[model samples]
Target: MAQSSSGTDGERRLDLIAMGRAGVDLYGEQVGGRLEDMGSFAKYIGGSPTNTAVGASRLGLDVGLLTRVGGDHFGRFIREELEREGVDTAGVRTDPDRLTALAILGIRDPDSFPLVFYRENCADMALCVDDIDPALIARTGALLVSGTHLSRPGVFQASMKAAELMKRQGGRVVFDIDYRPVLWGLAAKENGEDRFVASAAVTESLQRILPLCDLVVGTEEEIHILGGLSDTVSALRAIRERTAALLVCKRGANGCVAIPGAVPDDLDDAVVERGFPVEVFNVLGAGDAFMAGFLRGWLRDEPLEQCCAFANACGAIVVSRHGCAPAMASWEELQLFLDRQDWPHRLRESVELEHVHWATNRHRDYPELTVLAVDHRSQFDDLLAELGAGTPEQVAHFKRLALDAVHQVAAGDPRFGVLLDGRFGARALEAAADLPYWIGRPIEVPGSRPIRFEGAPDVETSLREWPLNHVVKCLVFYHPDDDQEMKARQDRQLLRLFDACRATRHEFLLEIIASKHGPVDSTTVARVIDHIYSLGIYPDWWKLEPADDAPTWDAVQAAILRYDPLCRGIVLLGLSAPREELLAAISAAAPFGLVRGFAVGRTIFHEVAAGWLTGVIDDAGAVAALAENLRVLSDAWRTARDARQAA
Candidate 1:
């Protein structure tokens, strides 16, 4: 529903909606170069709205949190945490039949933290308008909500109703567009062998939520994904007129600018406010904090730029600590940090920026472009599990999503290539039909002999009958473990396999210990080195792996480089080796650009592999903990891969 032009307006008393599920942040995954054998995590209440409430309250504002929590202890704990931070939690609803949301927070290193949420069919999704306290919203200043809650019908309906109410009351509605693809329904192919995602459902759901918000805040990349706008100004302008609200576009470190309206012409016509700078520690809550601060500024009648600064400062402070809500700060604390900065100021004649010229300038002309979304073999399983599709349909649907993802990424660049790997779900044949490049194995079909992927020479060949390329990411764990007997067999095959693949000169990903056939002798190392040097095309990248016998990073490097010098990356395998240690090896090997990465399935899947992957009755109804472990492995790979490219 559109906000009524006819209404009573006053100082904003924000009715912030924590529409998304709330949960506790748990720590897992590889950290500090060692695998953590422990499970206990420092508990903290975290969620987008929860953090926003704390950040806003810290900034001193009137904010109320609305959402559902279970009647369980975790739910009660969540409410208490909100109240402790001064957030008005009386509006929160309780569901007797459900459980509170919990987030599995993990660190692959300092930066690559991925979250696996347990909120499917949970209490948070049960939030409906019946749970809403209309009086609370009626007296509020603004409505702040996140897009995550849009995944479900009841919560979605409730959020929509609240937005309508806020609009009718002339209160501003702010949306922090955080779309977690994992949360938006995907499912696996039931045969326990394959998985895929439905593209139409994902797209249709995204389109449903874009029009309701007034001031939208999200990263440039997120905007590109949601709106398909590659150009900065044009994308903001494109989404402008679609909704009557101001379009606030974030350019990351460059700060954010708000368009008066969402229209192409608004780029040149709107009031643009530049942000004050702050040394950012954590960007997690900055956008939401910014929204809270913007409302805070609006309530206090402060200038727009000051609001952006407050938001950025709030974000900067949060990032400097751990979790979402670090601690709320007073105005003096924020201003003290701001005043310490020595920035150039303008009086009468500083720069030519502030002066407005009536001259109509030509906007940068961008070529007509196609956007393709690449589906890495990594996402195959998760997409499958989430979309809930059967084998045949999963293959077909996954094929399209994969093709679309690739096309989106390669749109502007001519050299862009889609790579399909058989190392993923049991069905790569569907994907292989389209992609031209591959790492290993021909895409295989189910319940029969595998078929060759139709593209160029790739992993869709022999020996790919395994998940080596998928489970063993080149950055984290390059390959799985094999006995000395298997090692001897591999070394003998390495030369012949190298020659056969060398015709295409395909570079196979190898773990030195796993590939070494005969012995740890230098002659054996030299022989293998000679073969690797022969067909030298880097297949994206080749990673070094620590030997099962020798877990140290130096030993792994010395073992590989004693034979070949180009070992830039390493995979930390071996069941006993700690993830933290492996990370340290990555750090130590930085001199060789060796700080690159590893593929660690066992390190991640050890829970399942060790028979420790089981959960109580709660996890019993869903997929096995091992399935989750595998998903975690896949998620970790995506995080690691993204981190590498981002660097």
Candidate 2:
């Protein structure tokens, strides 16, 4: 098993340890526009070495990053982001004298992305040999060094020291010739450079460290500068003569070629080509992603061809997206992509590949959530009809009343989320989108005969029209003993919805209620849950009914963990029970760590909404009653949770 550097046993077994640049990248949100006219920017953790480390970590590798960042927010942001992605930050140092590096990037065209580097005496470039620990390098299986750092004296010395330690310890030294000419004072501006004026000084500096690397990777143009030859074949030979290291050439879209050191005089026979065709979006971080993928396979002692293929796939995926580090796919997503028959084919432009990438890599940090479910349609109609007021105006008024109640309960709390539907709560749902709270909107009609989806004719079209930030809350009444045809139909419907949610990057909340056809006990619920997982549909949240006992909750929790550990904890659903009964159920479920919180709608606001619709109570009265119910339940859940934690 691969051990992380920060393991408690002090066992220093890391898959890969990288040393070099780390910075923040500010990306322009406006596509097809120049950087000057862009209005908004999205911040991402940038820098080649940092991106590679993050990519490898996401691919299930235990990696560590060694660099320095300023004692500022950007530095802290970089550290937090890396840690969140499972990269070891034990070697990351803080320097108070300088600011962290910054890169301003703009998507000017499909092939051109304008970038400005602000690294004048930046903290990352100020790395020193003393900052690198030789013991740390010895513990890692491989040490990856970025080439741009070698252009500067301070970082160059540090890279050399790290390489020396890795070589001395019998570990592999992988050198990524990440050539950024502008960073080395060779180019006037920061942009893509295919070739630069190769000076003796540049060649001598690169040659000094080339022989020390066990493996060297660079583009055709990068190899030109390293070998002082413009012709790629001649350059490959020149670099081969200088060092016994294996050479890997990066050919964008065309794939890559690997030449081993033990090859005979014939270079063509020894060269192995591997790659997949993909529509290029931005080629900025493709190389870094390739390096990460290659290293993942390389460290595991996989075949050279397999490593090259993996590298090509990683590169292809990143180039089709917008950002670099954040766009890298997880191991599962990569496998899914590769398993398809369309190895080199591109999806349509309407399909945002970034959505799938983001959805797969999304990190779950919410250990506990308090959700207020107000997605009641049929129940609301019944209440309004009982009051002799079943008009559209009355329904809209009732929805507003519910929204006001939710707002009152969620005013001072940041952990509150609301589940609203489109039937009568469309306006409320729109208003909830503007609030600083987690919002969940329903996709299935409240109580269709066989549970029909709302909105467009198909689930995909409906999801495409949904706001990206809102979670797709799907309620299904499924029983373990339903007829084969009915079960199969619902199964196919859910599978389609899951695929749509994943493709469109919508967080899903699957609310499952056992149908009245069968006895709905904890065992039946667990059986239904198991059946859902067996179908391979994983949702972000599971809104389930409260279990009767600790063992029952444990069974459900075990099923969820067994199927998908990434599944967020379960939230209790109200079955239109009384407020006191719902509170009791929440208290019983709150002790289980897997039960995060509750999503009780009718119990909290059904009576209040009815009174407001009948004009028996004023708007303020309804709001007060609804708010009190929500607060009481929220307080009860929290108290039980805190007590369980304390005990």
Please state every model's RMSD to the true fold in angstroms: 22.4, 8.1
Q: Which 10-residue window in model 2 sums to the lowest lDDT?
A: 347-356
TM-score of 1: 0.46
Clash-forming residue pairs, model 2 = none
1-647: candidate 2 lDDT, tens digit per residue = 12355556576568898889999998777878878899867688999999999889877789999999999999998998888788888789999999999998877776678888899999999999999887778668889998888998988899999899888889988888887778888777655333466766777788788878888999988888888888877888888887888899898877888888653454446666656666777777889999988887888888998888778888888887777888886887677667765543553242334434554587545777887788777777777678786576777766777777777988846578888877777888888866766788899976653668988888887887777778898889888888888888889888898888976668889988884567776677778889988887788889987665777788888888887766767899988887778878877888788888988887887777767776788878987898888889889988989988998
What is the Å distance of residue 280 in model 1 from its true position? 6.4
Model 1's lDDT to the true fold?
A: 0.49
Index of the highest-lDDT prediction: 2
Over 203-232, each residue of candidate 1 has an lDDT whose tens digit, in order, gives 355456556666677766555445545666
TM-score per candidate, chains pooled: 0.46, 0.68
Q: How many residue pairs clash in each candidate?
A: 64, 0
